[model samples]
Target: MAKITYVNADGDSTIIDVANGDSVMRGAVLNGVKGIVAQCGGGASCGTCHVYVDPENTKPLADMHRVEDELLYFTACERKENSRLSCQLPVSEELDGLVVHLPEKQL
Candidate 1:
């Protein structure tokens, strides 16, 4: 299992142990973490699961897809260089202790 830390807009943090191969969005939704709407479930169609990967931990994540890259522009939050759709990030031993900061909203 990989331990992932989700930090909400207000700075509150929730840590969850995710099974290997689970997406970060699924892990957060399963753990009831607030701020992540995950409206499209695990699909890349919606950008509701947007998150900012800690700069120090971004290396382990897979490269962004063109669809995710395009959808991110529609997110309610400001998109940064580290912004990513959590559904695109798979949990793995390499991602243990990964930290993702949530945006102020997920509309």
Candidate 2:
């Protein structure tokens, strides 16, 4: 299992324990973490599941696929180097204590 911390725009944090192979977006939705709408589920079609991964914790993540890369441009907030669609980020032991910063909105 891995523990992921999601920090909202206002600095509120929701920490969830997730199993390996579960997507970060799925973890948030399951735990009722705000700011992750996941409108398209884990399909990577909608950008509403956007999150800014802490730079230091990004090394373990797989490279973004073309679909997720393209969809990120449509997110509700400014895109950053650390920006990622939580739907595309699967959990793993290497990502324990991962920190994901939520955007101002996920609409």
Candidate 3:
């Protein structure tokens, strides 16, 4: 399991233990953590599960796929260097202590 931290735009932080092989979005939703909407479930087709990976994260994430990359352009929040789709981030021991910041809104 991996302990992931979800920080809301308002500064609230919630830490959840996500089982390995689950998506980051699923962890947040199941834990009832505010900020992540995940309108289309864990599908990268929707940008509702958007999040900003901690800029200081040292773990190596898999390179972004074309579908997620393209969908991010239409997110409700401004895309940044750390912007990512939580659904595309599968949980693993390597991602322990991962921190992701939620945007102000998801539409």
Steric overlap count per candidate: 0, 0, 0
lDDT of 1 by residue, 1-107 (tens): 89999999889999999999999999999999999899999889989999999888744788899999999999999999999999999988999999999999999
**Least accurate stretch of 10 residues (summed lDDT) in model 2?**
54-63
On lDDT, the candidate that comes out on top is: 1
Cα lDDT of model 3 by residue, 1-107, tens digit = 99999999989899999999999999999999888889889878789999999999987687899999999999999999999999999999999999999999988
Clashing pairs in 2: none
Q: Candidate 3 clash total?
A: 0
Task: Give the alpha carbon lDDT tens digit for every residue of 60-81 in model 2.
Answer: 8878999989988889898999
Candidate 3: segments with Cα more than 4 A from true spot: none
Task: Note the Cα lDDT for every prediction shown.
Answer: 0.93, 0.91, 0.93
lDDT of 2 at 64: 92
Model 3 compared with the native: what TM-score? 0.97
How many Å off is the CA of 35 in candidate 3? 1.1
Greater TM-score among 1 and 2 belongs to: 1
